[model samples]
Target: MKKLPIILSLLFLTLCCVSCKVGRFVYYNLANITDYKIFPSRPLVNDSIVFHYYTTEQDKAKVPKKINYNGSEVAFDDFLADNKTVAFLIIKNDTIQYEKYFNGYEQESIIASFSMAKSVTSILIGCALDDGFIKSVDEPVVNYVPELKDNGLEKVTIKHLLQMSSGIKCEESYINPFGDAATYYYGTDLRKALSKMKPEREPGTEFSYSSCDTQLLGLVLERSLKGETITEYLDEKIWKPLGMEYDASWSLDREKNGLEKTFCCINARARDFSKIGRLYLNKGNWNGKQIVSENWVEESTKPDTGLGNVDYYKYQWWLSSGGSYMAKGLLGQFIYVYPSKDLIIVRLGKNYGEVAWPELLTSLAENY
Candidate 1:
């Protein structure tokens, strides 16, 4: 009977170890929090692309040290400090205006894009549209993903996914281990993970932010190409043409033929990420060559009326009241573009305190 006690003790230790591991995983993800970091990403190489350098002539004009925030004035220095900003860059008229790096981050350091990858994925969809791989944004997702033909997902279209109005029942809670977001982030089989999802409402009826919409779009992109990997397609179409200075990486769910975590977690340099803004600012023309269609650029950035009352989201890009669009990621990664002023601002940081960024950007646009 003494063996019963020892067996019970062993089982308890095993359970404790398992619980500890799970706890560590949740703590590291911190999906519920706004200040979590994305790590352990895979490399997305840019081998054939020649480096394209931005014309560098630093402007010495001092940015405003203070701006209004929530009926109170807040210093920009304090904003950076309180928000744990690691890098801040500004490019105006194709010239580097102000550039600074903090927290030991250098120009060459690769940072995670978190949800900014959604914008990139949307760009890929544009490229696919241009290539005729995708006939139109109005096409049903089930047309490409035959597995979802019988499911209720057939009602969803590419436009709905891009606008985050797919109406899928995928909860974007990162903290819940059993939630759809966690499963898509950590699960091994993305196809299986996506296949199980069903629409909770009529597709495109209302706007709802869910990462699963983007993942489904990624699958459609993959299936449309028939056999091309997203990394390869990205390198061939955008990365090479945009003249990216550094190679970027996209994280995958598994090692062999694993699907990219397309909804988030693209690792790239701050400067290279700015190229995207430049592309849109120039109306999809890069160095006199058209990359993405001008029509697509206009359609993607402007607010979609189909999203109902939500005017902030448009084709995976975030829209502001001033008609300026931005690519934002978790934990304060932002690439703000103002085409009217030929201005682009890139901010990479660990966290951003509750500061009025739109007001700050607008002020900078007006002043500069």
Candidate 2:
């Protein structure tokens, strides 16, 4: 009966492995719900950065009770109640006009940015280009990431990646436990995970929103910076200089020198997030300091290429009608910038429902 022991051992090992895989899947899939409680994150420290407090003139404004959506009016309070909105803040003329928090979220509560980090990564690329670290956006990504050479990615340029036109064969299905998005999101070795990717079509020929495109861009930034972590680079280049109030955090694939998930997951206070919108609204200028080049800001937000209809996507930023642009996240997180009206609106929430964001923002801009 010695074989009984062997069979039991084998069964035990199989069960253990299955359990581990299932645990990982559950953990990563539920990150949206649980990460605000437990997740490894790297701090974007605000060292010696002066806090730019918003001028409190809260009462000089009125919150619209209802907004029109698809020819029908939706109650703003009903929208918030149904959508799990945690925080919403609006800044105009360099002052806080309206701010509200729900679901026990406070002014100090740090909310996850999700895919909004993609735009932040794009900004870092701009900073790298401005500093001459990257010679040009048209330069082949292989120039920075040599390992991608000889692969189908040989011809993919930085601009292609930024615009989500890389045509990489990375499926972005969040519901699939074994898909590319989950692998990149939960897997520890980013380079290993990326090595398996193959180009689906000619780069710069089409547009497809894939988080791996930003992850590759992050890799380019990491390679170009010569051993500097993106967290450090951002803190020194943008956060510190722009005077972000609270220290922010970026989630990593694993602990200690692990790659930051540049496609998503940056947790920061709502007020500080507004500063990002303000920076873009000021055309990359922060109180007269050119944090990102004005030309870069202009080019990044405009649809220069006619691919993917070019009406919405531009260098990781989502464009809208009325010359408005925004950095949007998967679950209703948004930093909407209205340059014409000099308005910055920040919304952090779990779901947006059927709320017409552009119409709502346009109405708010008109009223304010």
Candidate 3:
């Protein structure tokens, strides 16, 4: 009978070990959701978290017969069902051919953009430069945020931040509880968290993807615009000018800062997000207006670094195989553009676990 106790202990240990490994794969940290304090609140649009609204503008483009893609084939409906993808909009040539929302998602629901907002911020930066609000990406970041002038950040260039090449002391290991990503999200003052960082390497010497880099860029943009908010800049440059049907909102820190330009939580309609892709595909032109310089658009989408080519990040967009670029966010948010193919696809979802967003995107692109 003494073996009974040992057997029970062994069973408990086995169960604990099994749960830990399974939890690692299925559990979502979702620290940003909690850290941002985005409790259940009124959405900017409709009540749902995913929806679509067709623009009044007539469709002026054609649909492609077939899409080019790499990797294995996947059924669109099956993927949507299995992944719990909140929304999907496929624009081929120029007309939207396929759009669906699952799991009670509906039109006018403003799903959070997460990291996709970074690419949107990049577009706004291009507009700010074109309009002479900021002279160039080569300008020292401290020129705008004078508080950073004497700090080590003074040496960091705007381009460096955009390309995620800022050699700041940042570690983005999401799994590590003590890592910068978790600490930054959990902290009340994200900028204060950044302020505490001492440079571990020279600015722009190495490539390291850091959400703080984009947040700092947000601060710089706000400073350049004379304390104008990022939402204000976006409204002027893209949202209102592009004829966005409804108001979009950004969740901010405790200070009510409107410049959470990175790390997500942008609440906007699916169509509005799709417009961003269309704008890039059209080379920054919107309704006969040069919203952003074509030169900037071209340069911002091309691969800039040589460290690795598997996924080349340009500005805030990621360049994939076959001249495709996209703004991708955690949990499957995407704003993909293929200028050569004249295609754009915007997918928003909460598939943090149990789904392959990249693979699903590849499937959509293949069917395009």
TM-score of each: 0.87, 0.90, 0.78
Candidate 3 residue pairs in clash (backbone atoms < 3 Å): 51-106, 51-107, 52-107, 67-368, 114-264
- Name the TM-score of candidate 3: 0.78
For lDDT, candidate 1 versus 2, the one ahead is: 2
The parts of candidate 2 lying over 4 Å away from their true place are 1-22, 33-37, 66-78, 307-309
lDDT of 3: 0.68
User: What value of lDDT does candidate 2 attain over all alpha carbons?
Assistant: 0.80
Strongest candidate by lDDT? 2
Q: Write the per-residue lDDT of candidate 3 for residues 1-368, one digit (tens) a residue.
A: 99999988876775564323222222334433222234222223322322233332324433233332345355655556556677877776556676777777776676777788889888878888877889989898878766665566777889888888777777876667556765544444556665665566777667777887887787777777886667666766777667666667766654444235355567776877898888888898976988899998998888765532224788888887678889987667888887777778877776644565566565557555
Q: On residues 51-158, what C-alpha lDDT tens digit does candidate 2 reach at each position?
A: 564666545565566766567778866666566888888787887777888777888888888888999999999999999999999999889887777676898888
Q: Cα lDDT of all candidates, in order? A: 0.78, 0.80, 0.68
Worst 10 residues of 1 by lDDT: 31-40
- Residue-level lDDT of model 1, residues 68-175, one tens digit each, is 666777876566656677778778877777777776777888788888889999999999999999999999988988788667787888988998888889888767
Better of 1 and 3 by TM-score: 1
